[model samples]
Target: MDTLTCHPCPLDAAELARAGRDDPATGALGEELAARHLVADGCDLVARNWRLYAGELRGELDLIGVDTAEGCVVVCEVKARRDASRFGGALSAVPPRKAAKIRALTAAFLREARLPYPRVRLDVIAVDLGRDPVLHHVLAAL
Candidate 1:
């Protein structure tokens, strides 16, 4: 596994915390952190921000990697927040609807990329960039 970081993040941690949810810098840093964390946990990265277009629908997968230990493909969704406590934390953001979409995206990815694996798992990484940066990882979340 290789280390990944937000190389082009224009905003510092403090600035990122102050920015809105759609701020690209904050999202990038969050994804980078999640990627590095997954790598440390023994995932071989496949792609980041992988977008797929099938017919009229388009879906973007935040992180797609292989969990070497499990011998399976791992699909990760990353959610970041400055104050997680305010909105029931980041995990709550991924509701059933989002999970369903992720499942659809996984099928599309496997078909389009012709990727094969013994199993496929859905995971979630929640990053809180408040007083201290905290990461919450949920394995096989969906």
Candidate 2:
């Protein structure tokens, strides 16, 4: 498994704490943090919050990046939590159904974008917004 250690962002902890779980800003901040971490890890981000609709299936992909070394397209699902312990942490937040949906969305993206990558990967980036912010990247998560 490939992983990267990320430091806290400039966003104030107080603001995030007050935002709570339903706040869109909190999730947006998590996506931003995940994107930065991916870039730092040598992945080139190609998309963020990409929404797709095919027939009756519709969903959004949080982040899409290319592993520079392996030339693999990576579809990332980002989960953010105020506390790591609550709700099984951000890492385990993605259930099997969600993973399956992500895979379908990835297929749609690949077909629509006509990306020539030899392989594709599913990843999850968990953002813990406790006293000390932590970012965990799980490669090939699904």
Candidate 3:
């Protein structure tokens, strides 16, 4: 497995540890770590922080990964917390502003990347940073 260190994060790990319930900093490193995890699981990563299209209607997809599974492009939004208690509040953490952007961004990514796929899935990998980093992946969003 290949591991890449994300140095000089705008917010330090210590800062993420004490992030508020709905704070964006909650286990922020999990995105990079989770991206690695997905790659290790055999997903072909096409883009990281894919900012496709523009203007009042644009999107910023976090990760765009591909695999043979259903010929799908997986759009992953990662959320991580310190422990199990942080679970219930974790999924609620991805603010509408960010989520909306991601939703639009993924669309632009697909449109611009010209990814030919019969199936596209949006997923959220929520991790509770407990003993082993709990991951709750949501297949679809409402």
Report the number of clashing residue pairs per model.
0, 0, 1
List model 3 lDDT by residue over 6-30, tens digit each.
Answer: 2222344564555444445554566
Model 1 residue runs over 4 Å out of place are 1-22
Whose lDDT is higher: candidate 1's or candidate 3's?
A: 1
lDDT values for all models: 0.76, 0.81, 0.65
Locate the minimum summed-lDDT window of 10 residues in model 1: 1-10
Give the C-alpha lDDT of model 2: 0.81
lDDT of 3: 0.65
Ranking by lDDT: 2, 1, 3
Top candidate when judged by lDDT against the true structure: 2
Task: Give the clash total for candidate 1.
Answer: 0
- For each candidate in turn, the TM-score is 0.80, 0.84, 0.66
Candidate number with greatest TM-score: 2
Give the lDDT of residue 110 in candidate 3: 75
Write the residue-wise lDDT of candidate 2 on 25-104 in tens digits: 66877887889888987899999989976588899999999997988898999988876766577777888899999998
